[model samples]
Target: MASTIVSSIGQGTGLNITEMVDALVSADTAAKKAQITRQTNNNTAMISGVGSLRSALTTFQDAMKKLNDSSAPSFNAYAATSANESVVKVTSGNSAVPGSYNIVVKQLATGSKVASQQFAGGSSSAITSGELTVSQGGKSYKIDVANGATLESVRDQINKELGVQGISANIVNGDGGSRLVLSSTTTGAGSDLSLSGIPELEIDGTQQMAGSGAGYITAKAQDAELTIDGLTVKSAKNTIENAVSGMKMELTGVSTQTNGVGNPTSVTVAQDNEGLKKSVQAFVDAYNALQTTITALTSTSKDENDNLVLGPLTNDPTTRSLVGDIRKVLSEVGSGDQLTTLSQLGINTTKEGTLEFNSTKFTAAMNDKKLGSEVQELFTGTNGLFERMNKAIDPYNATDGSLATRKANLDKVAKNLEDQQAALERRTESLTESLTKKYVAMDTMVAKLNAQANQIKSVFDAINAQAKGS
Candidate 1:
């Protein structure tokens, strides 16, 4: 006796469920990996934005500090001391006689010293009581020197040597030519020349000295005391070029006849406080622009996505961080009792983080004897505010500094992203392989089920036919 058994499963189905599931899983994995990569990019961008804001803020603060410091705007000048020394005297011109006359010296020409051989011929001496000749560029000059001639006579002979060299030889007229004098038409190191033969006897009334080339007497302005707005300024240069910008004062009415020693000339320097005011205002304007930029970066707004567009990272945290950093750098605290803060120097910030200048307040601060001195010390000291600020931001400079570090970090992150992407691609390939195998198995199973169903139907049809024939 045989028992009947029933089973149902197989055939060419409309779709393969197993293959579909595998494909969906692979797609989900790829999308997740892509999402992680995008987040990394966003993080890198945010870091860059914050770094840029910090740098700009630092620069703005530095400029403001320099402008606020009162000492930064001061100027120096040179004053004339000697009235007669200021004038050049042409005692004896080539065409004029040697006479005493009050001659104004527009420019003083420094004298030079030249050395040349005085040839002499005799039975006892190699050469004696002969003329020494010098030639250059087809031009020559003869110097007459007597045998056993003194150094002064030899210098005098060479002094008389004349040609393209445009040099004049003479005794320092006042010093009885005691000092041999050589003068060049030009001023420079190459203008002077000297030549020697034997023994190089001391000439020019001085030890035989090498030619100093061409040189000049540094005619500096005499020190003069001038009162500017009740402030006395002493300068040693003739023209007061910096007494006021664009306005130069020439020292006139100088007592040319008198030997201007211990003589004081009085002149007034008008104060241009208006010009100083304008400069301060310009600095304020620049500072305001920097503040605006920082504010914009840190602001956020809601978008259609119902998400914060800029977020707190843009407005609160980054901007606040920058403000804190700037304030810390500018604030002073030490035993030296130097500058304390911008406000102490009359540069106070508003609620909006922009600087405001109060002239009355600033003037009062400057007038404060102790405070003013302290403020001055801050700008020129061992550990001044500017020095500290520069030290802080120096690393951000383009060459092997903070900026370089940031750039290096960015490169490292980019490389990491690339590596992650490559890893994801490998994962995806593995997923694809698994999905393909699963789909192939599903396809085979469906085919076999359909064949089994067809076989069962054919058997039932043949059995029915036999039964009918019976």
Candidate 2:
């Protein structure tokens, strides 16, 4: 009877059939979504792993950089001091050799200065609109003065043009309202102040204002007089360089005291040992941190529940390979010096694959003359351990390099999966629309057929009743 009723109803049950088809479509789509989800999770994990590896490599690189910069006071640098800071102060560079020197500053260098022929006032100009020429040591400059320009404006113009080396303009208020004064920027006899182009002004380094036809010589340009080890030396300026190999002495004042805190017999330049020791320890700490990060990423451990837990990068082959590569570099012997290996300086690896520095052994090595020199060479030499390791690790840590390549590839995978998911969703939507339309058509047709069948049945029953009554 159900089949007969179904035959009469035709596709009236299509909605139920469409609903079943919709369930099937959803199931298929769910499988595709599951695949996309799995791919996303896997790619995310691998990307994170690469990030960890990169961070580790960068930390190690920074540690290596410290060993390369010997100019830092913490590494093979020189420290120079002056016994008398009041009279003389000293600072040493990497090239300075350890030595002692006795120095005496007799006179400080002076630059040429001359007060201009008194002007009317500080802001007043003798000549309103004119080009003034100032020359010094065969170098000349022409300064253009604006119409009705003041002496102050002329001063600004001269300074702006840097009119002449060692020639600076100034104004002073004296018995006269203001006078234009020009001085030298340098402190030596060769650097002398001079002026020209204006007859009202006449200045010279060696001249008296009222005597002769020359202007007043306010100050004379002179050289600094000093003695190094009793050998008289003359410097054009106060700052002296390389008088003693690798030493630059700046003379501040004349010698007024003997060798002591106020003045000493020697200026000493020596190596700073404690600073280098601290640098080595810092390198050890950085190296250990890198090692710990690698171990944590590549190893497995038991969780709080005592269940075995895998590290984020435990399955990554590249991370494991990097560890092996770094270990190989660390263990290699350096051929340039007697301090060929890290173990000689007490930098040893722990059982857990981390570095350990033995301070006692390192200090002893630092004190040994033969080993100390070689040890410094080992770290700073051209093919030193730090140098070699830096080369090995550079490609991996550089941007868009090894680790970045893996991340980029994973990014592409994720994008492709996303595209696939979008296509599947559109296909599902189209399928749902097609099923709904087909079901609606079937319901409409079935209802029309049922209506016709009922109308025909009523006609047959009416005819049969008429025949029976007759």
How many residue pairs collide in each prediction?
21, 3
Those runs of model 1 whose alpha carbons end farther than 4 Å from true positions after fitting are 1-11, 16-23, 26-35, 54-105, 108-268, 282-301, 309-322, 333-341, 359-385, 395-407, 455-459, 462-470
Give a tens-digit lDDT track for model 1, residues 358-418: 8776566555533443443454345665566556555554357655565577667777777
- Give the clashing residue pairs of candidate 2, or none: 166-185, 259-264, 260-263
Best by TM-score: 2
lDDT tens digits, residue span 338-429, model 2: 57888877899889998888878877776764354455557657787777777777767778577788778888988898899789888887
Poorest 10 consecutive residues by lDDT, candidate 1: 1-10
Q: Any runs in candidate 2 off by more than 4 Å, and if so which?
A: 1-22, 51-71, 77-271, 296-329, 332-337, 351-353, 373-376, 381-386, 399-414, 439-470
